[model samples]
Target: MRIVIALGGNAMLQRGQPLEAAIQRENIRKAAEVIARVAKDHEVILTHGNGPQVGLLALQNAAYDKVSPYPLDVLGAETAGMIGYMMEQELYNQMPGAQIATMVTQTLVDNNDPAFQDPTKFVGPVYGKEEAEALAAEKNWSIKADGEYFRRVVPSPLPKSIIEVEMVKKLSEMGALVICSGGGGVPVRKLEDGKLEGVEAVVDKDLTAALLAEQMGADALVIMTDVAAVCVNFGQPDQKKIHKASVQGIGELDFPAGSMGPKIDSCAQFVEKGGRFAAIGSLYDVEKIVTGEAGTWITNEVEGISFYEKKEEAAVA
Candidate 1:
């Protein structure tokens, strides 16, 4: 089976964990173990988010003051290479004989995309409103409210095409595990004359992954994030975890736009476009996810939305 696995950046670098090199590598190492197992029996194409990494790089770049902070496109490419190298090394260690490659991909977007007018994608560290506003003034950054805190936000355009998608498919057809399109492939826009230039915006990785899967004719799109499953009434007493849903079933639901929304939309788009299935679950559960033993699976095979039984809370000590 052919699968495209989208790794959530926050999942790879666990929330609240320090953005240290060794820590990130260890996390990727753990992820590689599961991916290696999946790659053993089936073809795998990998894409990962660079949210945390890119934000950290931007912070570091801003501090240097030697040159203006590098644009988001450049930082996105750096994160792709940085994260891909770690994943490549770890995967190679697990499977010395397997073919693996990482490409610096580009996702083409339109300059006129409405997303530019609305910067909703969050990046960088959260700060108090006062501090955030000050930084925004200093850096010419757009700041937005994220929960009680504020953070940098950027344009996140819809993906029109992946510039190197054919090569990605060709490499995968040749039996290679290809990792590409980190941070939505360094968001680029093509000029009227057909030249491409990096745009100063981020592209949603989940949407880009769906586009990639569609173009590659993948059998399944598996989005591996930190969450165990997609939930409705999340964090409320009546919370329910979706285990299975038909394409239309999942489409009717609501999820947080910055987080699960893109994931849900991506899965629905893939299945609706005739992919066999699309799944969402923890990165650690790939083994179970493939067999439909775990995770939220979206397909037309199911009649309506079905949810996993509520897990009982642990007894208090």
Candidate 2:
């Protein structure tokens, strides 16, 4: 089956880990092993998040007084190239002789998207509220709460189309495990002359992945995150894992704007648009997720929503 897997940023950098090359590659090496296993039996198109990577570049650029900091579009492209290179190399190492291609894709967004007025996407490393505020003040950045900590935020416009859709699709048809649309494909908008210009915002990768998957006519759209399943009342004592859900049923729940919200919304959109499967779960267990052994599966095949029993609850029963 053709599958589009959107790898969350945390899969590589993880929370609280230093953004070092060795560390990122090591994490990717492990990820490649998992992906290699799945690729052996299916056609896979990969997309990845760049929340931490781009933020680190922005920070580094700010530190250098040589010139003005690079634009988010440029930073996003650099991250796509850098991260794509790493991922491709690792995948090649894991699956010798396997075909793989990574492209610096461009995603089209509205020049006047309301998201420009509302900076909601979180980027950069997490920091305490005080530290985030200090950085925001010094850097003239927008800051917002990311769970308990805070981080920089920028406009996250919705993707309207992919500029390189035909090429990406062609590559996939040729049996390559293609990686494109990193950090939402370097957000851009069309000019009056039909030319495209880069935008200052970041497009959410999950949304782009969904759009890509739909356009590619893939059978499944899988969002691989750090969590085992989508949870309701997250981080609370009564939190429950969603084991299965219908597109409409799962779309009604709430999730954090910067984190799980896009994942849930993207998956729902895919399944609602006639996709056979949409899932959310840990990247390490992607094989199980695709096979229905684990994670929260969202589809029209289910009647409604169902929750996984807590270990204690199941044991007692």
Best by TM-score: 2
Error of 2 at 102 (Å): 0.6
Model 2 ranges off by over 4 Å: 311-317
Whole-model Cα lDDT per candidate?
Answer: 0.88, 0.91
Superposition error at 73 for model 2 (Å): 0.4
Which residues of candidate 1, in runs, are more than 4 Å off? 128-130, 147-149, 311-317
Q: Write down the TM-score for model 2.
A: 0.96
Report how far residue 119 has shifted in candidate 1, in Å.
0.8
Query: How many residue pairs clash in all the candidates, one count each?
Result: 0, 0
Tens digits of per-residue lDDT for model 2 on 1-317? 99999999877899989989899999999999999999999999999999999999998988899898889999999999999999999999999998899999999999889999999998999999899989898888999988788989999999999999899999998888999999989999999999999999999999999999998999999999888888889878898888889987887787877678888899988888879989999888799889987788999999779988777223212
Q: 16 in model 2: Cα distance from truth in Å? A: 0.6
TM-score of every model versus the real structure: 0.94, 0.96
lDDT of 1 by residue, 113-140 (tens): 9999999888766778899999999988
